[model samples]
Target chain A: MSLFTQSISPETLSVATLARIESQGGIDPFASPSHPPRVSAPSFRLPARAISAITLLALIALWWLAAQYKIVSPVFLPGPEAVFRKFITVARDGFVDATLFQHLLISLGRVFAALAATLLIGVPVGLLIGLSTVGRGVFDPLLEFLRPLPPLAYLPLVVIWFGIGEPSKVLVIGLAMLAPIALSTAAGVRAVNEERIRAARALGASRLRTVLHVTIPSALPQIFTGLRIALGAGWSTLVAAELVAATRGLGFMIQSAAQFLVTDVVLVGIFTIALVAFALEWAIRTLDRRLVPWSGRD
Target chain B: MSLLELDHVSVRYQNAVRDAVADASLRLSSGDFLVLTGRSGCGKTTLLNVAAGFVSPSSGMARVDGQPIAAPGADRAVVFQSDALFPWASVRENVAFALRMKGVPRRERDRRADALLARVKLSGFGDKPVWELSGGMRQRVGLARALAAEPRFLLMDEPLGALDALTRERMQTLLLDIWAESGTGILMVTHGIEEALLLGTEVIVMTPNPDTGQQGRITRRIPVSFGRRYRAGEPVRAIRADPAFAAARAELADAIFEGELQ
Candidate 1:
């Protein structure tokens, strides 16, 4: 199955790592006197993931019972089958001149595009706040001002300044993301082990070389965390930005459905967004595992 | 003049009421293994940091052959108490970090790093990440990395402090071996009186100055021969077994305890 359909979660990653390590016959890297010995068998632990799965089933059963009993109006809370049927129809035929896949693709495009822009702008800003007193003096207050601002709070102001266009949409999303990326980058830079920097200095590294080789690499895990947070912010602000103008995105699809009180279609859109967010988290986590493998291990 | 000297060096940190190291005089030569031992508040580490050029003396001079030390250089490489290794790099890469900073070629650096790792007896473990290694192994990597700089004086701040007792003993032997072979001037700081006596050609016990209320000052200096005895084809346990070794440890311990109580 594609990553979007995969039921990846936080708990599974650790279990998978443990299984891989045990399979290789190496003792657990973190095994200590306090830690109990590993089972050395396999990944399927009953109490571990089964509880979440059961909880999900119970919630779905409750939803079905409530729908069947007409406890809430159908316009507000549709049955699961109705939502599923709407998902199929939207995937095959078009919903508001675009299919479900098209809406999803456009939404992903906007988020990723905004993500690219934010990364380009945010990383250097973060480094500045981290590296020099002057950089911190200039940028720290700006970031403080920008952070904690709701995307909706800035929507009208962005629209007024940049005009209602693709730039404004991307701008709005990018603004929401810049603070997390920049702030996390700065924190990571500041948190780099003091001795590591001192070691670099004593080893004939020039100031610039020390930053490029030691400082940047040391700050990478934190930078990646910032990116993940920025991506999350992008997803959250996606619908708000799309609600502004001409759009063929997931946010627009959900908003369009809500206007007509198409509760089933709205549920389907919401579910798709949630699933896609999970997929994004999984993809970034895999990337983090590959790129910053030393993060938590130390 | 000594090759490295802390000539009555004293340091008072910003906003501090007293000096960390108060008018402390110490010296080490190319073949000397000098150990500074004291209570927790005593500036054994602060004194070492002065020699390493990490901290500047507030009222006294730190010098190299009377040149006056200004900044840290590869001439004096330090192995920190925490081992302060780069987690992002593999063992070989971490070992070669000094060479890499010197614009050495990748292949030559790798070759030299592997040789150094082997010197530390971590052969075939060059490709491993630092965290995968045991504490003792990581300390070895720190030593190997310091050696890669080919420093004239190898300054260590309790480099084996985090290791288990057995590992710490093994590391003490390795350090003595390195000192004899490389002839690098060694300045080390430690709390273990036995460790100081076992490894130091000259051991100094410093006490926090009661007058200054937390400033460190050297109170006693003793020249010992166990490190030299270990060098003279003597086994470590044999040197430790000697009555002289116990005597020196007792003297050092007494000084530190009295310093602590004061």
Candidate 2:
């Protein structure tokens, strides 16, 4: 009785009703009237992880083949296995007079020293140039002149002044790292929206308060970008500085190994540098994600 | 005393050959809504900027509450055409920035920002990044940011010009609602004549700079008062739709665009 009251049989329905029912079966509302079939948006495709793994395997195979066939001398191009053996030897017997931990500590210490000094000087100068018309007028030209000079160019002069010591090394690397950071910071500062500045002023904020609350917070992402660039510069500059006149550190080991033509040792040092650079880069990316959580995903 | 007054104010940029605005004077009372309408480059922006103390007059002077205006101050707040929210900040952070500058504590500043955002119909958008917002939503955030300061005067320069037609209409009604609640003095600049007619309590039609000639010398100036203060003399839409607006508009257009004011 309930079924009879609530429903009509398909056979009993009229042609118009049947057509409406048929339309409900498969017709998409969004389909264009002129087109027989609906147009669907193309879905995005991501590169598969399996593809990346295969690429890695292919690269390793090529390296092994080159080494095994003597396409390059073993002295110059050690097989992956040989390189791994050297790595295990270093891990056990150390790279030089110092252990692996000692060399790492020295490198990390140098980087930290240079970074600290750069931050101390770069941020204030950047903010000054960014915020003040007078400061920009005075300092911008000076900065532009200094920014392009490579850090290696300063080593000879720094050595003459500070004489083959850690101080000279630190000064060279720190100054090299300073330019990009300060410039990027200034750019960030200048790019702060004028509306925010005006609004801050309208709220009875003193000049100092405006700079502190509005300007600095707005310019932070750019400042972080500068720091990342500066870190890279410092790392590369540290290696170059160490290469010139150093008794310790990975760069020194590479330089010493190159002199003796111990390509295996040199290769080991090169691999270590690459590994450390990768680690530093990964740390910076993680820092960026954490600090600027709203960094333009859209 | 008039709440704000412009005394023979004229502005000329240093490189420009002619004054952008010449010998413009007006008196505005508190709670008054003033709309400025003219041909492009007839100096509507220059006049509003001078009034807000963003730009100085090349000649004459401007006064607020009988005091001579000199620089941008807390008394006047501006809503810009671009809706320039800081892209790096979340909507809440952007709204709270002005308050933070004024030394408001963190708790209070956040509270006030939330309230202001609510006023602009953007209550839950506080934590959203600016880049994630649509154009209309960004402009609403801008309006809320400006209103957060609670200034004595509000200066808007084509604040809704970037929005689509439907959004623009909605924004206009929203602005009217906010105005009714706040009662702050407003000076708005727009190229849309109908918008001026709909929004202004007092409408001032500006003439383009004139050259010496019979037609050029006869620049029309009319004051439109509407609604409760209509004075039983003129119909608002009829006055706006009248042939006089067209003639004035054309004459100003010729003066500005053709440089043949006469």
Candidate 3:
């Protein structure tokens, strides 16, 4: 039977069932509490290293088949071996007076700095708006107006304000990042259980203390959700910002290579972006796991 | 002197045409446990909120210890029917939340919280999150949280009404124990007539709203000492064997369901 249905009051029976499901005395169906239990007795599960080799072989076969048939032009879609050679050439020769490492580092630094700036401004503003009616009243109209305007839409203004320097790139990224974090924090704050707030007040908590202890803590799960969304936006905005003005970042490299019809190099840049985004998400998920272990049961 | 007094208290919501609670007056003195038994929406919870100072009465005085009650404070703790334990917090942290709000040191808070949990018979489950507990266990945590504050007045709104028959009975007994130990005057709201009789020093039978003015009152006080020592299983046997217990229970049930006797 489906766990949730509109017919049954989930609040009544499901809550009780969920409570029983989360109980500590019983082991999770999937995870064993004691001594790293196996989900299914391992049937010689291949390591990623082994799987990578198999994947490489499969790709090579597909590439060789395509090349042999000439269904696609070699110039447009290079074979796996040809791409590997290009990768080696780039690793050896470097591009635009900078190595791949330098390009990657510059992009990473820009994104990180932008994200940091977004967090510095967005979180506090979100909290202020979220916690008090006055703050929300003051800021919500402005935010609603701003939230819909694309981060790129503010490009000309930001360029005029800060110039096309690293700061401007960071500012653009931060602006893009801000909405998700601030909006999410506000949502999280609003969602904090009212009962907990009352309970805290009853315990003699001053207004400020209650916000700090009860409201923030209870809102944490939702706050992290907002952070993840903000990070994704920040990453996208960073790439867009880099493309517009930067001479040396990954986005610039891709744009420059595309102009020269160096498709292989452009592909590499795109792959690098995908890899970086994945890593950032992985790190955030790890942090979320540590911070909100209770979310795992659901 | 009255320990807590609501003099002609009235509350009307923004959208509602009539008052939710209108000119309701109640006086709860020291050592008195008042149970307000009525139908749902009979304004028992609203009255409790007015007493706790969460809801402002439109035009009446609500005073505790001769001081006017305004915003919610540690002086009047409430145990909600929903249990309302912070889902993010472990059982210990949930109980200790009030103490933490009171600026109790972490170690002291933990110690006091542990004792409170033990009082509710939730000793080993302190580290478990509120979500990890049974409905009854969560309610126990709510009870523990209210008790941890050591409030001057306790306001319980059908706190044990959400539980099963067995757990509800156990909690009623637990509540009596806590009340006796603390001597904090209680104003509980429950629908169960038997529960009101078992727990209250005075049972107030509130008539449904739109007909609210002065409604119901029963003043045959239950002797606090009668069932203090009896465990869960023993109470029914002993109480039923006593003829007076049956009579008082009948009287209370009648007062709640039927019209009050003046």
* Highest TM-score model number: 1
What's the distance in Å from true for residue A79, model 3? 3.4
Residue pairs with clashing backbones, model 3: none
Writing each residue's lDDT as its tens digit, candidate 1 over A113-220 gives 899999998999999999999999999898878776778888999999989888888888888788878887887789888888888778777788888888889989
Q: Residue B213, candidate 3: how far off, in angstroms?
A: 13
lDDT: worst 10-residue window of model 2 chain A: A1-10
Residue A268 of model 2 has an lDDT of: 77
Off by over 4 Å in 2: A1-63, A132-134, A137-145, A244-247, A293-298, B210-262
Question: All candidates' lDDT scores?
Answer: 0.85, 0.72, 0.75
Each prediction's number of clashing residue pairs: 0, 0, 0
lDDT of 3 by residue, A123-145 (tens): 78889898889999988887777
Model 2 per-residue lDDT at B172: 69
Q: After superposition, how far is residue B13 of candidate 2 from its true place, in Å?
A: 1.9
The fraction of correct interface contacts reproduced by each prediction comes to 0.70, 0.54, 0.67
**Candidate 2 per-residue lDDT over residues A97-119, each given as its tens digit:** 87555676787788779989988
DockQ of 3: 0.41
Q: By the DockQ metric, which is better: model 2 or model 3?
A: 3
In model 1 chain A, the worst 10-residue window by lDDT is A1-10
Q: Provide the lDDT at B68 for model 1.
A: 92
TM-score of chain B of each: 0.96, 0.82, 0.87
DockQ of each: 0.57, 0.29, 0.41
- Score candidate 2 by TM-score against the native: 0.78
